[model samples]
Structures are given as C-alpha cells and as structure tokens.
Target: MKLLLYPNCSNGGVTAVIRSRANADKENTYLVVFTNDRGGRHSFDDLDNVTVRIVPDFRLGAFLTYLFNEYVFDSINVFSMPKIVEQMVQRDELAVTYEFHSSNMSIVEKEISQLPLDRVASLVVPSQEMKSKLSERLPKRLLPRLQVVPNLVDEFVFNTNGRSDRLSSLEEGLIPLVWIGRLEASKGAHFVPRVLAQLPENYVAIMIVSLESDPTRFDRFLAECDSMGVAHRCHILMDLQQQTVAEFYRSAAARGGWLISTSLMESFGYAVSEAISCGLRVAAFELPVWSRFEEEPKLVQVDAGSVVQMASAVAGKVS
Candidate 1:
C-alpha cells in the first residue's frame, strides 16, 4: 500500500498530483523531489503522513545513497522522468507507474520503448489525445497498460473572491491577458511578442513563468519583446503560490480579461481549466486534446501556430 511519488521538479501539475494523492492516502504516500526547484515544497510541509525527501544534487553518489538506504518503496509513481522509471524497473520488487504529462513524446519515446513493459503496472495519461498519441508510439504489447487519469488543479484556483495585490500596480484601462507556462520554444514563449503586437495597444500580457524555466531563454524572450516594441505590454511574474495564481485568474476575469495558452502542444490544459473554474475567458491554440472543451463558451480555440489568429481571438474575446 506504500507509494513513492517522484516528480522531475516541483511543477504545479506534478505537485497537484502529489498533494491530491497525499491527501487521499496520507498514511501510505511518500514524496521524493530530485531537483533544487523548491516551488511546490510548501504543499507538502503540513501533510501529516507524507514523508518529503529532497536530493538537490541528483549526483550518482547521492542517488545511490537514497536508493540503498531509503528506497524501500513498494510502488513508485514517476512523473515525466523515464530514466527514473528505468532505474526503478531494475529493482524488480517495486511496481512502477509512469504518469505521462507532456505532449512532446519524442523526449521520452526511446526510454519508454526500451522499458520493461511487463514490469510496469500502468502508463497514466491525462487526455484521450495523449493516450492515442502514446498508442501510436508504443508497441502493441504495451497498449493494455495505458490508463487515462486527468490532471488535477488546486481547489483554491476555483475561488473568485480575492484580487491579486500584484496586479494593483498595473495601470488603469489596460486589458490583462494572463499566460501561464514555461518560457520555452515548445511552449511558444517566442510567439507572445507577435501576438501582443497584433492586439490592441492597451492589452498587456501577464506571464506567470514556471520556476523550472530556463533563465537564459526567458531573458531572450524579454529581449525579443523589446526588439518587437511590445516589451511595455508584457508583465512577467514568477514563483507564485497557487492561491496567488488563483487571485490573478480572478483579477483577470474581473477586469474583462482572459487567459492565453500559447503552447505548441498540451497533453492536458491545467491552466485553461483553472481559468475556466474561476469564470475567466480563455484563448488558446487549437489542439486535439482540447476538443472536449469546444462547446465551452468561455474557451476560444484558434489555429495552431497562427499568431495572428490567436491574437484576433483574444481581441474578440475581450472586445
């Protein structure tokens, strides 16, 4: 009944899974963080039955020490880390489950293909589209192990009462467009400038960049904004707590603004769901994964990679 949860970093979605499971089965769950990203550590601090372990270096010596001395986990749940799953498979006593969260399967395709599929208990995915994508990439023998488990957002994100104090400093009359994700090429951070350029001059993009994001790339994104003459319309925020993020969603909704997802791909749109839960409008690139939400009035889907179309959709939503 004991479970070990190993997430690559303290990502919001990954941490949500850890929190939900810990709350559900507090007595038998353990959380092991393998990176220096401490973004989601607060969520685990007060849990009575959850054991939290941190291995900052992730060096071979440190990993071996953790594996030999503290690795008595009966079952391991891995998130977005194939190498960890590979390591766990070597220990035949442990039942391993991989929770697939990324739409970009190329990164882990080789690792998954080479894995001991028979030893894996399940391959959990968040969306039917992801399940379908994995099906095409994986061997037919591994199809039976695929499980569809939707991503969970924090309950606080649904609350609409509070206002984000961080947004208070923003000038009046500007429409706030909230963007949440890493500042990476795959997530479409580089496209924001062009999208903003296409929007009304009063529109401002409030980007909540993930802690696991690359600093160099983010700086480059900002530089690109400057070059594009849209830097003034961009507001960058980072390392925010879940409750604070909810407030931002509420604030945006209250201001007649909406959330925007510029991701090239999404296995599951947690940010989009959270924005909708808070009664905010959303404009995102059309993806097969978001087909389920097509009927939702608050969601506006545009052609993928069409910056002009995305900008037009957001402008129309706010207008």
Candidate 2:
C-alpha cells in the first residue's frame, strides 16, 4: 500500500520510528513523506522504499501540494498536524492514521475532533501512559480508534561483535556510564551534575554525548558541572554515527554498567529501550512508563527531580 507519512517540522526519534516501520516491511510498501522545507534535514536520510517531498509553505502551494493531491494516497499517516488531517478530510481521503507523541495529543483532540469519524483510522501511541491520557481526553466518539504500538528497538543498532571489539578498546579499571541525547534545557542537564555529585570516587567516568543545540544552555550545564567539581570525570561527546551509538551501549552492557535518563518528558524512552535490550542496566525518573522498569532488577528507578536519589540509585546498582 502507498502510505503518505506527513512529518511536521520536528523530526528526531519520530523519524526513526517511521523509518523503522518502512524498513520492516519494505517490499509491499510505498512510503512518501510530506515535509516542510525545514523538515528535510534528518538522520533517516539513507532509508529505502521512502520518498521525501518538500511541500511549499505558502497557502496556495500547501493546498495544491497536500490537499488537492492527497487522494492519490491509499493511506495517510500523520504525526503532529491537525490542519493536515483537516485538509486530508477535505480531499476525501479514506484512511488517515495519527501517531501521538507526548507533546501533540492535547492539540490533536482539542482541534481535530469534528472531522468525519471513519476517515480517521487509528491513533498510534508508544506507551500505555500516553494511551491512558489519550483515552481520557479523547471525545467518546474517537476513543475506539486509538491503537498502541510499543516503541521498537532498531535491531540494526546492535552489532554484537562491533560492540565487543569497542569494549576492549576502553581504558581498564573504570566503569563507563554512557548518555546520549540533545544538550538542552528540558534535557535535565542540570540534574546530571547533581547526580554526579553524590557518586563515590570509584564510580569512574560518565561519557555524556549530546548534539549541541543551544550554546547558552550547554555552557550553563558545563559551568554547573565545573562548580560541582565533577566536570573532570564527564566526557562530552558531540555527534557520533548510529553504529557508534550502538557501540557505546555495547560497551556499557559488556561492563554491566548502567544508562541513565534524567529528562522530565519522553514519549517513549529510546535510550532506555536500547540499553535494556543490549542487556545493560537502566535508571531513570519514575515517569509513567519508566516506573515500569523498576520492577525489572536490571533497571533502577529514581524519584523525579531528586539528583541525590538518581545518583544513589545508579551508585547502588554499579557498586
């Protein structure tokens, strides 16, 4: 089937999730991504059975590109746009599926509820927590349409031999704690310094790899780390390839080390899944879905907003 996947401006993990679907069942699928010019840059550039279209920003251009031509699509998969769903309905498209992330559900239900019911096929969410929230807020009319597809780990990520070989290269006598994500305000970079402060001297190094987005916030995080005197033990990695990311996970798993997620919000914890699947331990804020991990001995759960608690959790696991 021809699936037209409409990705709004922000494409991070969502693009990966979509690409995973396309890559999974590549033979029978024709995946077309309708993106604004700004959404063109992404890590999922090498994907096959996927065509990228940069729709124009102007009203006439948008209407002609997205609205008028949408009927050619057999199915429409939308991530983060109520207006696009409205336009799809206007064009008489039969099946349009909405993928929900933590940030967009409120706007989805609040603005797009009046659209013809059957045309909206299903709302795919990553976690039960998000599904619960969607179920609670969805107009009773749209409740039956929500579908939960748990976030999947990209199996291609784990190259066991490559990870094992990389693990051998690391310096001996130090247990590595690897973290990778964006360096931003909401990323809880502030909490990281505090988590490090409570660790014992023997816990060794933290390789905190992040894509540097805002310079001011990045500087603030480093400054706080310096003030805490834990800066010397933290290595800030800037932009590595996906295979290298998998290697980091492998190294940690080899050493029986843990991966930590301090962020306040995540629709689905990508690193948490990658780490746990690689057989490494995990620690995170007791957010809705993350709390579920604590039941597994491999994962350590910490109270949200408590650095000492997170550090203690990690320290206890590592020791």
Candidate 3:
C-alpha cells in the first residue's frame, strides 16, 4: 500500500520516526509531508519509493488534501494534527490513523474535542505511560482504537563506534558533562544552571541546543548560567549531524562525561536513550516514563524537581 506520513512538528524524535518507517517498510510506496520548519537529514528522502515534501506552514491541511486528490497515497498516518485529522476522519474516502505525541492536558483536551476517535483505524501513542495518561482524558470510545508503537533509532548509526579517545586528549583534570534538549520549561531548562552551580569546579557542561529550541529561552538560559557564575563553564553547540551526535556521545563516554536530562516530562526521550546506547553514563530525573528503561545499569535517576539531588547524583556518577 502507498502510505503517506504527516507529522505536525519537526523535532529530532519526529524526524527519526519518519525516517525509520520509510526505511523499514521498503515494499510500500511512502510519501512524507513536513512543514518548512521541520529540518533534518531524512535518510529515506532519496529512496525511490519514498516521496518527501516540505510545504509551507498552515498549508499542511490543504496540501495533504491536494495530495489526496492527486491520489498520492493509499492511506494516511498523521501525528498530533487534531483539526486536520478530524477533517480527514469526516471524509469517507480516506483511510486515516492518528498519533498522539504529547501528554500536556491542554493539548489532550483539544484532542478530546477535535479528534474523531471512533472514525479512524487507530489512535497511536509512543509510550505506555502516554497511553495511561490519555486513557483518562480520551473518550471511552477512543480506547479500542488506541495502540502503543515506539519510535525507532538507527542502531548502526547511533552505536558506539567511529569515536575518538577524547579522555586522554582533553585537559587532564577536567570532567566533562553534556546536556541535549529543547530549551523549554518542561525540559527543565531553568534547572540546568542551578544543577551546574551545585556541581564542583572541576566539572564543566556542554549544552547542545536542539533544533526548534526557542532563542529567547536560550538567552534566558545563558543569563541564568551567567547569574550563577557557571556561564564560563557551559559550552553551547548546535545543528550537529547524527554522526556528530554519536561521535560526541562516544567521546564524552570515553572521557567519563555524563548525559544529563532535567526534563519533567517526556513521551519518550530520544537524547537520553541514544546517549546510553552510545555508551555514555546518564543522570536523569526519575520520570515515570523512564520505567521502561529500568534495567539500564548506567542510568542514575535523581529525584524529580530537585537540583540538589540531580547535582549530587551526577557527582556520584564520577566515582
């Protein structure tokens, strides 16, 4: 079947989802539509059976309709596009599926109103925790349509290889740490500088500002770092390729660096998982979603909402 995938946002996790599906399902003709704001090296873009288009913002619903009229896909799979999904569901001619990626209550209320849950083939959530949360807000009729399907990471591309021994090459006395995420409140961005302030002087942080992060928020984060007097120790990097991310992870791991996640909520955390897979030890908040990865030995779960605990946990990782 020719399946078309539409995602409302362009973050690393969403891009990874699109690329994974196209690569895994080679027999099907896959068409992917993204807004101009979504940018990533979509590895499947060049595949003969996969057609990818980046249309302008707010034109997505109309663009998908245009593609539908052109008969570009046999069925449609969309992530978190509520109003459009409702419109598509009303159309008896189209086969559709809706994916829920957020656990935010306000967004959940919108889905409860706008998503025609009974009309679609399925309602997909990325994690069981997300499903449990949605189970409360979504209509009982929507329950039967719900399914849990995980996002994928390319094992070969993200694994611990093609990395340098950064341990010996770096300054001998310093311990490095890394943080990767959108500079947003739910990610616990404000807590980062606080955690850095509590850590010892020998420790320094490398902050990787992800795509789609708010520049204003980033400025605030820097100001927080400056106010805490740790701005000089915080290094900011941006727009790195996947290979480079993996390389950073591998090298940081070799140098005894830890991957830190201050996020208060996550549907599924891509950066933390990828860092662990690439051989980095991790110190993250004890989010309920992380129960899925309880067996990972390298992970240290700090008490959520406590900067002192996170700093203490990260410091403990060094020993």
Candidate 4:
C-alpha cells in the first residue's frame, strides 16, 4: 500500500494531487486527511479502491494507529507537514516523501529545516520556481532531494462546453472575465473591483469563489465593488463544481472573454492552466510559475500588482 498524508483538505491543489494519484493507482493508494472542516467540498471522498481516513485529532493514538498498522505501506507521501513527517520517520520500515505545495517558502523552510533530512526519501514540489526557492533555503546536501512535479488539472475541464443559457443576465456584447479562487487578501481577490473599474463598461468580471464561513469578506468585496461603482457589472457565482467551472471558461471563450488571475503568489497556476486547456485566454501576473506559459498565445502576462495593466490586457481581449 502507498499512503498519502496531508495535514488538512483546506487546499484544493493538495486535494487535486490526491485525486489524481488515487485515480492513477487506486488499488494501492490510501489518503489520510487530518482535518475535515476548513476547506471547500471534499472532492475525493467517493473514489473507488481508495481508502480515505479522516483523523481530526493528530494525537499520539492516531500516530500509533498509522505507525503500527497491519497494512504495510511501502511508501508514504506527506504534503507540507514536517511534524507528521517527524512522526512517520520513527517508522524505519516506511519510505517518506515530503511534498511541498505552497509558495510560502519561509514558513515551509522553517518547518522542514527541523526535520531529519536523511530519512526523507525525496522532496517533491509542484513547480521549478518552488524547487529554486526551496533550494535557496535548504542545505546544499538536501538540495539533491528536491524534485519538480507539476499539478494536473482535472480531465473533465478539457471536454466541457459552454452553457449560454446559464449566464443569461450577461449582456450580448459584454466580455466575461472570470476569476476563480478564495475571496481573500492573499489571493488578491480584494483587488478585483479596482481592476474591473478600469475595464470597459461592457467587460464584466465574474467571480466564482468559495464563500464558506467568510461572509464578511464576501460582503466587504461587494461593498468595495459598490464603492468603485462596478458592482452592477460584477457577478459572483459560488460553490461550482469542476464541470460548471469549465463551462464558465467555455462560456467566456465563446464570448471572446478570458480568465484573469490576481494571485500574489502561486506554487503552480492550476486554474490558469485549466482555463487555457478550455480554450480560454488568460491574463495573469508574470509569476515565476507561469514562465513556461509566457510564450503561449492564449496567456497574457501582466506586470505584477498593476491592476491597470491587468484590466487593459483583459480589455484588449474583448471583442
């Protein structure tokens, strides 16, 4: 058996990885998720041949259950939890792999630096940018363990077609600019209204965000939109599935619109890539992770933190 342990399911990216791995090799894969409440919907709970164990409390008993289990796991892939890795290292029989998924390298470095590097079989990161960042912070000897494995978008994204009837409120001449992610400061979602304010009146901004337990932020975003006088042109769609999100991408593409990302940091631009796969144009900040896609005709890299530049790029894409 192969065990994949993540501290929580708060991150969709980690869940994506787990889903991909489970689908690829379901027979031997077992996912051990630490927490259940924080993140959006649990997307991997129904996979066949994959066992999902939710241990809310990360205590010694839980650790003992994993450590002294009858089912022997040949390899264990841990996602960004040094403490978990520390405990798993106690089991001499298991090969532990540390998978890094965040752009917050300082926090990651601080946590990982305390672990016994020699016991780790390998260190996996989602992108080359992450590999380089981790290399700078880690010991020279430990740098050899770093490996880059990019995230995979869900296969359903590629085959989805536009649903013209769904977004009926959008005017015929308007260009739909889609933004997907958590509506938080870190995600740069708060900057969306300012960007939308700069765009042409016909270029509407559609936000498909997870509004779970964060009503204040959502209300504040609406208030900001109203203050900026762009609330009328902005639409918020909540709790959409992967297929529905793909349809939005397709719908935007059909209308000659595109995806816009204002993320301050990204380990890998999964949503951006997915948008591109759906034949939609993308205007995103020129982050290190998107370097490979810079040459793609569908992807437009705007100056980081420049809302005007991002808005202008999206405006240019509008017919």
**Could you estimate the TM-score for every candidate?**
0.87, 0.80, 0.89, 0.88
Report the lDDT tens digits of candidate 4 across residue range 1-319. Answer: 6677675564355766677666666566564555454443456656665666666654634754645576777777877677767777777877788888876666687768767788898999889998888888777988888999878776644445546345566778998889998876767887788998887788888898874675888888889999999999888887666667778888888888888899989888888988888888999877888887856999888888999888878878432
Could you give candidate 3's per-residue lDDT for residues 195-309 as a string of tens digits? 8899888788877777654578878888899999998888888756566677878988887788989888888787888898898988888888899787898898888988898
Instruction: For candidate 3, give the lDDT.
Output: 0.75
Report the alpha-carbon TM-score of model 4 versus the true structure: 0.88
Tens digits of per-residue lDDT for model 2, 1-319: 5665554423335655666677676675555555553333454566666665555444523654544454466566776655557656654545678777643454557645654545677887888778887788767887788888876667776444555445565566566666666665555767776777788654544554544445886788789989988887677766555556677777777875678888777677877877776777777777777745655777777778888777777777432
Best by TM-score: 3
Candidate 1: tens digits of C-alpha lDDT, residues 215-264: 79878998999988999899888867667788899888878888988888
Each model's lDDT comes to 0.75, 0.65, 0.75, 0.76
Ranking 1 against 2 by lDDT, winner: 1
Candidate 3: minimum summed lDDT over ten consecutive residues — where? 3-12
Task: Return the clash pairs for model 3, or none.
Answer: none
Off by more than 4 A, model 1:
24-28, 56-74, 163-165, 212-214, 317-319
Model 2 deviation from the true structure expressed as Cα RMSD, one decimal place: 3.9
Q: Which ten residues in a row have the lowest lDDT in candidate 1?
A: 1-10
TM-score for predicted model 2 compared with the true structure: 0.80
| Candidate 4, run of 10 with poorest lDDT | 156-165
Model 1 vs. true fold: TM: 0.87
